[model samples]
Target chain A: MNAFTRFASLFGAGKDASGRGGSSPECRRVGEVLQMYLDGEFDGDTSWLTDHLDECADCGLDSAEFQQLKDAISRLGQPDTDTRQRLQEFADHLAGGEMDVVDDPV
Target chain B: MEAAQTERDAAFRSYVVPELDVMFRVAMSLTRNKADAEDLVQDALVRAYRAIDRFDGRYPRAWLLTILRNAQINRTRRRRPELLHDPDTEMERLSSTKSGDEFDPEAVVIDPVFDASVRQALDALPKKFRRPVELVDLGGLSYQEAADDMGVPVGTVMSRLHRARKRMRDHLEQTGFGTREID
Candidate 1:
């Protein structure tokens, strides 16, 4: 237990050593799963996160934290009226003309 | 003068003026400086005007962007380089906090310091990483859209995005926030 605590403090309990307080291996694994989960990329590996989370406390915490953070960041990044207007103008400009693509046919 | 006037008048108005803001924003993301961005956008507009009559009108935004990107690249190739300091690394050095200053959780994260750091970090990246980061994250185009724009497969976009995001996070860590959760 002492050695484990030491390992946790030194290596951040499996968190990144780069000063981002490396997350646990379990957390990283969970993060990978969550990426696939949110992307809906895996219909086959349905029980991965479920079974992993059941055993990994750190991963569970990381998952919850990541979800919350994702939500917050998404809200912060949501397009505002001005941004939308800008994009609309861009779209309109795009509708005005096509670019000439030079072809090299031998 | 009449010919020039006629050409200028017909060269375009709605697109030239209306798209300026979008062009400026994209340029800003690419150049990371307002003056340079403005210059690049202007050059791109001029180039676009020259080619506008021949344009196919298939994908105007992508086409314009390609020209703008090319202009930016051209300018970079010709221009003398300026010295840049990576703010992320500097921020990391200052993370000591011996002064006991606390970062505000509610303060805007897009402040000049963070923005400059992000810009610098992004500029430090290779062109391969820079492209997807510029397209997907800053430009807010979807993967398929960017794929079409870049003439690459969607998987390539995904790969570039994954690498770019990882590189960005790594850059952030190296500069400051070493081990701090970015998201």
Candidate 2:
């Protein structure tokens, strides 16, 4: 099986005969707030979540994946040099009262 | 009058000039097109200039970002209605570049293939999901700031942004993105 199938099977292992994955309640709770925890926006106590992440391999991997995704997304924010230069010049003109505001034609 | 005009110009330079790059980045996040983003920033700057005399000069970045958000909303309202969703057009606009030769090598932190996959995953997301990601991740807005811009409550922003990232993560994993080296 490929990596994806393998990773998915790990989650699948939590399922019981009823096909309701028997993952611990802690795991379920962690899953609910993992994004907020990673984003540093979680307001409540985080000690339990941290403890759970340390003990649960599956939850740890999930956290790592989310962190990686965030890092990748952050890299796209850099503005190119030409755009910066154009904006700088425009700001100069606007501040100097050299440019007039014209409505965009509909 | 001349002295007052000079003082207004100085104040504009001091308060608004430093934020031009940030304004463009947020505009790009909202519009997802280079030319359209530039136009949006232009409009916002015009508004800022016109109102500079009345600005209280506190929390300039917040004030400027609010102006930028309003400008984007107005621009959206003025546009001709989109008849139908076109994935190809959406992808093109999301990946739009002003010049091929203007590449910045330092900006790339991961493999091009991985980055392309991430962009594709981002492109495939529904607009409601995609906007939160773009605003928070690509535009570097805090959750509260993004919430304010979208006119939604903080809790709603948190929920949507979390769900959006989860969807993107699922997409990446399905594409074997997790197998790559991550550091």
Candidate 3:
């Protein structure tokens, strides 16, 4: 596996050998686990929440709320509209396109 | 040396120039000023260009960022001793107040109050925490991708991110901006 997949799997987000995961202590939430969830870093194991949501409603609610907080946090102080436009333009330039320069030797 | 120079020039056109803006944004997050950011980005690009032959090309952006990060460290080392001490103090002044406001404090507010709050919080984070947030949130790198770039275990990256977000959330709460309680 490449570095990306290697690292991701190490973080408990990679696919398991079984089609579905069996109950493992690894499923428990720690600070790091909550963090990955908040960042939407999951690999979409439907079984991811099945364990916690089944036993603990509080953790499940926290997970859902944390998702909202993550979304809102991302929106805070987002680059202004003009700056976003400029950033997009810059990204496009990197992706291979020329932007119109108002003043240039040409 | 000859091979390095040739490789550098080619990388400059193929990689560095194309990714200038992305590089600048990352540098801006590090140096927090336009002039310094420009210098940092240029320095990194030049170095990356020179080292292109050694580059594996598996992840050009990560490689460049590693070089840029090293360049930033070297530049920091060369700065006058007094300036390096409490560098955050200077950055704070730059961030809290406007760019230039001689008579009126409101005339040239450096950043909007809300934006300033956010910037201040981000700047306050430790490098371990800050780097993950900057790499993923601002630099648009994924968590796994950042782990590889930062050369850390993925669990470490997640911990840093969690701590960083908690710090940011606390700062926002203290400033009465964000209402989410971090526990």
Q: Please tell me which predicted candidate would have the highest DockQ against the true structure.
A: 2
Ordered list by DockQ, greatest first: 2, 1, 3
TM-score of each: 0.51, 0.71, 0.55
Residue B77, model 2: Cα distance from true site in angstroms: 5.9
Question: Which prediction has more favorable DockQ, 1 or 2?
Answer: 2
Q: For every model in order, what is the number of clashing pairs?
A: 14, 3, 2
Q: Pick the candidate with the highest TM-score.
A: 2
Mind giving the per-residue lDDT tens digits that candidate 3 earns over B95-183? 45444322123322322344445656776788889888877665556788789878998888888887777777566556654432222
Q: Model 1 scores what on Cα lDDT?
A: 0.52
Judge candidate 3 at residue B29 and give its lDDT.
Answer: 64
Per-model DockQ against the true two-chain complex: 0.07, 0.32, 0.06
Candidate 1 vs 3: which has more lDDT: 3
lDDT of 1 by residue, B127-161 (tens): 87677657655555566667876789978877776
Q: Write the per-residue lDDT of candidate 3 for residues A1-106, one digit (tens) a residue.
A: 4211232233343353111222455444432265565566866664656566444433443344344334433333233344435444543442231432212211
* Residue pairs whose backbone atoms clash in candidate 3: B8-B49, B98-B110
The 10 consecutive residues of candidate 3 chain A with the worst lDDT sum are A97-106
